[model samples]
Target: MAETTTDSVLVTESVAKYDGAETARKQPPPEKPADVRRRSLVIVSFWLIVLCLGLPIWWQTTTIYRAKLPLDDMLDWAEGRACRPVFPLRISVEANDLQQQEAQNLLRLTQHALDDLNDFSGHHLRLQLSPPGRQNESAEIEDTSALTIRLLPGDSPASALHPYSSILDITYPPNSVPTQTSSSSALATYIAGQLRSTFAEEQAIISYLLSTTSFSNEQRPQGLTPEAAESLAKRTTRSLKYSPTYHLTFSLFTGGHQPSSWDIEAAVDEFMRPVLDVLTPIHNFTIDTQIQLYAAPSVQSQVLNKEDLSSFVNAAEWPLSPSIGGAPTVNFIAYIGNQTIGLPPTDQDASDGALATSQSWLVPQWGTVYLLPLPEDTTHVSVLTLKQPLLTFTSHLLSLLGTPQSGSLPLRLSTLSRIRSADLLLRASSTLGSLARLSLALPSISIPSSVADGVAKTMAHLRLACDTLGTPEALYHARVAEQEAERAFFEKSMVGQLYFPDEHKIAVYLPLLGPVGVPLVMGLLNELKAWRKRRREALEKGKAKKDT
Candidate 1:
């Protein structure tokens, strides 16, 4: 009986301990209506502030700044719809010996023939008859006139471009002159044929440029054959882009200590100055020469083949950096070595005369490399010895500048200006188009106000260039357009912002929002539950009171 009583006492103690624990763990009384409403207001206010003010402020602070761009206008410029390139060449005909009426008739017939022969409408040739006995034809004619034609009566029909002037001198037989009643004349045909041949290279270059672009079929010239186009493509690739100035570097590299110096300054003054002066109207050149002794070439062969010639330049070891300005550099290297170029079996004999051994080779648009063989004891290169090399460099320079091969120096320079203008205009247009396409393809990229400004400036310059296509001012405007387009296309801010991703945004928002949002949402739910219970209890009490 005593043992049972002790067990009952222990059980009572355990039950008492459980009762105390339950009483301590019980929830407090339900919240009052005013308190519930206050908590709800607090939660709602927090969410309202976050949704309306904080989020907007955060978005505005973190968002990229994008200026408005004229995408439609940019696309139009790129598609060749904004501008049409037209090269209007004015040719003046001078017939001092013939009557004024005769010269006018000759000019009219030649103009008709040229028009019929020309398949490319973008490049038009208009001929004008000069007054009789007009002295100093070149000085009197405006800069707009590309070429002047002089008609002289002679025994045989012959046509030749004047070596010093942009004038074509033609000698026609007396019988070749067309009578007043004649519908067509032999003289007119000869003049048209001559003019066509003279501008053939220019036409081919322009047509090739159009073919490479996104030009429509109507704009493209009809006569470019596949082979012709391929050849033109090669030439275009080999030439450098047009620039206002070129840094001309003359480097003399030698394998040994001997022949360490050269009279390059004297040689340039004697032979190259004249050509540079002629090219001044189109381009300016800055010259600096250096002598590098004990310098090794990339290839170590005594007899270099055509394949070896290409790799002879050691670009890594050479100090041929371009000038500081926006001008491009042209390197002319004269390496003193005894290496001979290996000729093919057909050219093995010197007596063949058909294939002469070349001492130098042109490296496309880069420059010329002359393998000048000097005596082992020689310490210096004389100005006389450098004459040949300088002359070769001059010829190569002309080719590098994209000068037409079959004309006088003056005529070629004029042609070069026109070609450069056309090339730059197309290049700028293409750049603008590329930028437009890039912007369209990459929507996340930021476009700054500076980029928009540059695009606007480019378009303005491009329009100016188009209006004055054949003049020097046109070249200047095209150059500016090209620069501005390049600047806008490669804007630094746009590129820098492209790498940021959405993952970073999620990482930033989750940490701050998670903690604050969870408690506010739970508190609001609990408050609503208490308010609903209170309303139900009040309704029950009201019903009981009515029954009583």
Candidate 2:
């Protein structure tokens, strides 16, 4: 029984009977040449379509677009190679007491002396004779001049600056007027010296700015002292950045319940209004006032120190919100408190040049704070009591605007314009350089057409500003250039398409192409091998037939 079961398991196939001719295996008939050619053509066509159509479409979809930019010109401007700032200051000369010919002669001689004395190429003083009581070209030049020299017949030669305007009052001897035949005059030399003194600080500051920036040694100011450079550095750090408009917030902060009301409007009108009017040509100011009760300083000691002033502002508690519409705000605070500021031993005379007084101290780039010691029961602050603080504020405002300390108020204001122009020009150039570098470093970042347009406008306005450095128009153009450069550098759409990880790309593309590509490739390879085998068989058969 066991042998029968094993034999049944071993019987896997049934036996078949066939004739002798059927025992020989036979091959299928050979494929026709047309069919062989058709298979090759199909494989080639499919591969050609994939290579020509699919690859190009994929590349076009993934490419990023970049707008053309003036990169070379932008870099040139940034490195101070494209434009050298030059200030052409028109100076009008007038002498009502002298004849017109004498006035002309005096101006010519003074100009010669000035040319000999000036070494800086950036600032040029062009002397023009103002026609007496005539509304013509000379009058127009007078209106545009940076300064006016008014000559008067006097016992001796002396120059005095007009406190209210940009006029240099020069009194000279009667015989000091130059003749057309004379090459020089004592009055001309005296006037030249006065002019040099007037613009000395302005020239130094501009030179300091250039030398510290990207300018070459030749373009730098001829003589800049360490003391002057240090002073300029302090002023630069202390000043607020350039802005077309500044909001002035006059706030009265109190620790007690008293002094709820103040005559801030009347005080500003009486003391600070004139300075604001003078600065109107270069800057615009909007004034507002507020009172905050129970406001305390960050430092609560009865006596405050110099170090305490740095953190005096309770930033979290103060209602000193910034101004809107893209303009900066400057704060002036009068704190009614019993605490007195204790100056260090070395800073006893801080009021002289340190921008601090016994009762007040200036916060760099922010504003000024005055510790006003008032009676505990006082309810209203009078304008009379605010006279000194307001005056202090007026002076501090000029400092905050980066005004030179050595010049008179009018001359300082005029210098303010030139300083601001240079500052804006340099800032715009730096912005352009940064943008260029950013584009170079990031090959994949998209550059929008608006950025290119902004760069174009910036360079154009920068050129205009460089051509008219000393004029008011230069300031306007510089402001525009700076704004445009910033806009170009900060364009919102410059970030390109979202990033796709390599792992994710592989995951997506492998699944898509694996099914379609693998079969095509394997089929073509197998067809090539089979064709070679067929050729070998045909050659072997032909050789055998020849032998027969």
Candidate 2 shows a clash count of 0
Off by over 4 Å in 1: 1-27, 321-323, 344-357, 507-548
Which stretches of model 2 miss by more than 4 angstroms?
A: 1-46, 133-142, 178-182, 344-355, 495-548
Residue 311 C-alpha lDDT in model 2: 78
The digit string of per-residue lDDT tens for model 2 on 252-324 reads 9999888999999999999999999989989999888999999988999988776677778898998985875
lDDT string for model 1 (1-548, tens) is 99999999999999999999999889687677788678778878987988899889989987777678788888777777888888888888888888877778888889889998898888888998877667655676735578888888899989888888888989999788887887998789889999999888888888888777786666677889999888676666667678788999999999999797789999999999999998997889999999988889999989877667678789888877676587789988888999877766455233311121377766766888888998999999999999999998898888788887778887788888888888888888888888888787777778889999999999999999999987778888998999999999889988776676778768998998899879878877886786688789999999999999
Clashing pairs in 1: none
